[model samples]
Target: MSDASINASTVTTQTRVNEASFGDYFSLLKPRVMSLVVFTALVGLLAAPVPVHPFVGFCAILFIAIGGGASGALNMWWDADIDKVMKRTKGRPIPSGKVEAGEAMALGLALSGLSVIMLGLATNWFAGAFLGFTIFFYVVVYTMWLKRSTPQNIVIGGAAGAFPPVIGWVAATGSMTLEPWLMFALTFMWTPPHFWALALFMRSDYDDAGVPMLTVTHGRRATRWHILVYTALLALLAVGTAFSGIGGPIYLTVAVVMNALFLRGAWQIARRTEDDSEADNYKVERSFFKLSLLYLFLHFGAILAEALLKPYGLGGWS
Candidate 1:
């Protein structure tokens, strides 16, 4: 082959190798996290006292999901460095080289603006503003600032994840109320314990990445204690939410059962020695982490069921 032709072929091959697939861009959104956001936000929207138009509700959720995706993109962009080192995050789009940091940033910014504007046009300015603030909190406050700085990172950063329900409620009602805040409280309180459980099992990832997770900063013993303490508080808040307007027999039942299992899990975790953890392959910690996922989902699912039954005066207790 001629030298020029050989050079052109090499350039084409390199370009093809560097090209990102559609799934690569989607992976930057952290779809797993976005699913939780969508579910909680939907429950909040449904649980509100005022009814919303179906089409408008759909638009609000769509925009909110987009805003969530934007946050994920921005988080990936900012955390690309640490992500590359963490075993858990090394495969993320940016860290794995499937997506560029610059591209993620631009996508984040663009979606951030688009979601906020569309939410406001579809619902209300308040909801739009809340969505915008959520994006900023997750991307700027949590990922950029708190994540690298403190053991309390997840504790404070949890608030950003907790805001979606409140924003959803606002999207439906155009105002704030105690009920939506209760939903926010549920998520906020659940965050520390949920994450601490994972940290117990995955401390190496944070340690290697140099992130100050409680497990790394305070040791596994302290992290276990933190999980127990937070789980107790989360139980209080979860059961209390059962008495709120969004709660009912169904929710109360779910709360009692779930909290019992959750407390048991936390207590078991607290009782475990590091030796025990090693012996059992961190089974207790891993189980608690898995349970935590269901704990939040069932709680919100009960809330949604209550809302669906409210029209028949069968929702909350009389």
Candidate 2:
């Protein structure tokens, strides 16, 4: 190639990169999602029967958050083209033209490597391996393949989110057990209802993106039914965990009431319709969405409370 042509191409690339925006970089971190990951992972570390060094726990959680962020960045990069057309994601880093896809990809890859390696050095091999799997699963499996291909994306992709607690537990114990897996199960089961609710209301956005969400492919009514079913299952699995070794009186009590209310909300969503013009059936979907957030936060909070009240034997199972 001519030197003039090569230089022109290089300059064009540099100019494009120079135009990247700060919020675009922040979007790569998936700050909204990272908050929950940090919270749940911290609770898992604290609730574990085994105790860990303070510094070690801190390091483990930090690295896990970074790994989660790395996955988010990579996901945005891979999904950017479709994101530009989706109402919900059009403002994201890549779609918004604030960050180049290649730049986000580089950042994600760097963080993925660093988070896993540092986690292994700071904590244990198990924690690092789990983190590595999470990044790969979310990036390679969910984002690259499942997301655009199936309505079951959230179901299988949910595993990536569920791993944080298990990773936290492993960081503390240097191993895994039924209790941590139960916590993992709780999050895994909760994911569908939580995400599907958003999908129901944001149906147009997904259609624009050409993403095959259940709502887009299966119809809103079917999506609503799935949401209710998953919610019920989540409630059952969550409350039932109270019977497991990880659960105590406080956790059980919280789970029962929370799950009951959650079930009621799901039922309401299932019964309502977008055709009903009175209350805007979307309101039902939105309400369920808000409650779903609380359902998870409160459940984990109960676990944290149980761990704290162990000294007085107040929160332990009777």
TM-score of each: 0.98, 0.92
- How displaced is residue 64 in candidate 1, in Å? 0.3
* Candidate 1 residue runs with Cα over 4 Å from true position: none
Model 1 Cα lDDT, one tens digit per residue, 153-262: 99999999999999999999999989999999999999999998888888589989899999888888998999999999999989998998999999999999999999
What range of 10 consecutive residues in model 2 has the weakest lDDT sum? Answer: 272-281
Query: In model 2, how many backbone clashes occur?
Result: 0
lDDT of each: 0.93, 0.88
Who wins the lDDT comparison? Answer: 1
Residue 145 accuracy (lDDT) in model 1: 95
